[model samples]
Target: MAKAVWKGTLTFGLVSLPVALYPATESHAVRFHQLQRGTTDRVRQRRVNERTGEEVPFEDVVKGYELAEGEYVVVEPAELEELSPGRSRTIEIGGFADLAEIDPVLFDKTYYLGPADPATAKVYQLLVEALAHSRRAGIAVFAMRGKEYLTAVDSTDGLLELRTMHWADELRDPQQEVPDLPARRRDFNRTELATAEQLIEMLSVAWNPDDYHDTREERVRALVEAKAEGREVALSTGAEPEATELTDLVDVLRRSLAEARAARGTGPKGGRSGTAGGSGTAGTAGRPRTVGAAGTVRAAGRPGTAGRSETVGAAGTAGTAGTAGTAGAKGGPKRERARRAPEPPEAVEDLGSLTKAELYRRAAALGVPHRSTMTRDQLQYALKAAARPRRKLGKAS
Candidate 1:
């Protein structure tokens, strides 16, 4: 189990519950230590006095509020500590609002909130269900490490999540920051707009965050591995982006739509032309030849008397039953083939190397209960346990 970053009492309407907060997010970015040029020695930083050029200890450092150029008012730590909110270690809910009212920009960091003790689990669960049913979030102020935070407490999948928020004044004015935005009264070409919308529809796919990955991080790791193996790292210069012309917008949209349709294996009329057996290319006698992941060709097998499927092996060898049916006399009536369900995730032998995001995905696929609150190790253990077959109980002797 992960240690809680903060332990405090949550209060609302005279009811107080003890809760522990655990950070809900982590960064997977690769990090590197500072090193000296042309040397293997690590570089380090230190604080020093500008006038004396002497290193200063952390204990001697004090907070300073600058009022003007070259002038500052030094403040003591004790004074700031006394002024911090939530001195009693409490997060009192100021009010509740519909979660949709909160803008995405206000949400900063996320943390999981759970009952501090097993005895309070009932109250915690009640609160979670209540928030979920009401579709509202408790807006509260929290103090941790002498810093006050505006937080939104909401429930998701039977677990409460607390998201720290930026103050209203902290948000920047987009209109002021961005100078080249199109005017609100600007008119757009109706034909070009329709083409763009059509292109978007053609390219749309289901949203699955697991399908995306950090390519830059993967490249960095590959670079490190290649350097360790004393291998040359191949580099490529990508083609420069072509400048788009507004006059050619419709042509560009049409080209993009065509490319998307081709990538998705759809014809010009947005229809697929594959056999009912599988999505493979056209085969002889109107029987589709399926290609397996291992480069094996599978000739669609007709249902045998024993109701068994004759599959092709990884060496591109076809089964006797499959070939006989597929190579039958021409002009034979088309037989209906059974459609298979989507393939399940492949069994993973080693789960320790996977990141938390990947483990979460696997847990979700395995239908593990209460996975939102589980740590990475807990998720791995749950997945392994779920994969185990249950032993049948023997009759008592």
Candidate 2:
């Protein structure tokens, strides 16, 4: 059973419901022991009093804050209680705002609130049903552990969910940090714009929470478990590779978008393969067949100074092309057919590495529109701009 961390009243006008708050989530981070590398003995923390120059009982110690050099203000339990944010015994909800309007960075810890008494279950159910019908949540202030919390209270399945938020002062001003966009921007051509639109149409689907996974963390845990079991864990190189020549963006967009849209339904085992393709010629052709190559480039585009750079072009031939001997027709091995020889590796510029078609296809994946005529630099800039994660405000003190 989940344990309640707090018991409080939900108050808005005369409507009052006693609720117990329980943490809604738990961290799955790996724990580590501090140990001497040579001895392997775990290190333990000790408590010592400064003035007495002796170890002190854990129960005797009190929380203190330093105000001046070598000066401190020690507070007793009673004094601490007196200074705590005691005004909020009740979760007093004020109003509601569109969930999408929230910056997302403001959201912190989440707590689940349920009726404190079985008799008040009806009240809890009422709130949940009401919120579902109204499509609104309650904004409230609450307190726990002597700290005040600004939170959003929403009801779902007979329980109230409380998500704490950071203060306004905590959000960083991005305009002050990032540089202004270049003056001479490329304009989108009809084909580029049309393909970009088609890609969006292909990939568009209603949000579904189930369509996600933390593959990185899962892979890490799998490796950790393998090591713990004394098994040899080989690093995995994801997927096979092939190469195609860069072609028109229209076909690429169409191919990509189609796959994305097809992923929406309750159909295939894993929509990992389906999606609308971006519109363009040789849409998916002329590009590296493996996602690994493209993934590396995208990951490298972050703020840090470039440690290295990769250029993609025609690479060395990947063995024989369609030299198959006829098998089925004459009850023999199938005959190979003629195909374009794989291009040899050439030092292509970063811009050259991705064709206009490839750029539009990628821009479609990222939900950036008007991509057809977008220059390689524009495409790169847009990708970086769209991939920004929500900024967490005021890291916990």
Candidate 3:
């Protein structure tokens, strides 16, 4: 088990519970040591005095704030300690807010809060249950390591999760830094929009993180291994493909939607051949294809376009049915059957009624991807979408 990083008491209203904070996440990125290019000697950094050109002892190091260009106010360790706030062991909750209201950008680091002693377990569970039932997170200010942090405490997986947050003033507006952003709205063709929506629906599946892989890390490791074995490694110049200019938006969307449906084994096989610009060309079948923002198709697939053999599973079927019911209301008997179809379980309907932690648990159970980083609303939407049924596509006349 990981060791606790902080020990403190959590207090709200008249209740107090002893708790210890444990880091909830860790980084596993590969590390490299600094060494001389030719020699194996490890590179080392040292602290030295600029004036005396002598090494500085760790104990003698003191912090200084620059007053002007050449002047600094030197602060000693003892003086700094005296100026610091008194160490407080209590984390006092100030107020509570709906978890959805908190912006995800503000969250920094997260730590799990565990009961410090067996005696406090009951109180700890009480707080967790209260936060979960109320679907609210408690806001608090905490001081640690001589620095104060704004934090939010919420219940997750039956435990308390405390996340430090950036101050409101720390956030920057992107519009101020970004240049040449579109100022005026551009109208989109209705058919193009409908096609895009269809493509999204066709490609939509339960989030399974295992389906993704970090190829960069694998390539990096391979390069390192090849160099260690004294084997030749060929490197490629990183060049991006030239951008394509789009003429017809609706045609491109239709082709792309057809391709996506085909990839998933729902659309017709064989490519549609036509002029590159006004009438887009649907390249050969069974290839990994992408429809660029400019509506250009980059096709590289096999001979025949085969339907995707993967099943949507039970959760996916539920999500697809729900979605189809909402979209196919105008279709005669099918619409009535869809309307009469059972609604999603009460738990799903009351998603907003549960805490973020409970929502996360539900997402995990439903195989939602990236649940850890998803906002509450995103999770709810994904769950709702996953519970709906996929729409059936008709063959072209």
Question: How do all models score by TM-score?
Answer: 0.66, 0.58, 0.68
Best of the candidates, TM-score? 3
Candidate 2 local lDDT, 83-158, one digit each (tens):
6444446888788754434666678887888889999888888888776555456888776777778888775555
Candidate 3, residue 258: Cα displacement in angstroms equals 2.3
Question: Which residue runs does candidate 2 get wrong by more than 4 Å?
Answer: 48-56, 84-88, 96-101, 177-194, 236-397
Write down the lDDT of every candidate, Cα atoms only.
0.60, 0.52, 0.58
| Higher-lDDT candidate of 2 and 3 | 3
Residue-pair clashes per prediction, in order, are 0, 47, 18
- Cα deviation at 352, candidate 2, in Å, is 47
Q: Candidate 1 residues 180-212, lDDT tens each?
A: 754454255555555565545544432243434
Give the C-alpha lDDT of model 1: 0.60
- Report the alpha-carbon TM-score of model 1 versus the true structure: 0.66
Across 1-397, the per-residue lDDT of candidate 3 in tens digits comes to: 8999889888899888888999997765557899999999999889989999999999989988999998999988777545534334668898997555566678899999899999778888889888877767899887776667788998876889999999988977645655764453336544444555555544443333443445466678889999999999998754343343366454444544544443343334233222112222222222233332222333332111221122122211111222221122123223222333223434436777876666665665445543675667656755664442222222223
Q: Please give the TM-score that candidate 3 achieves against the real structure.
A: 0.68
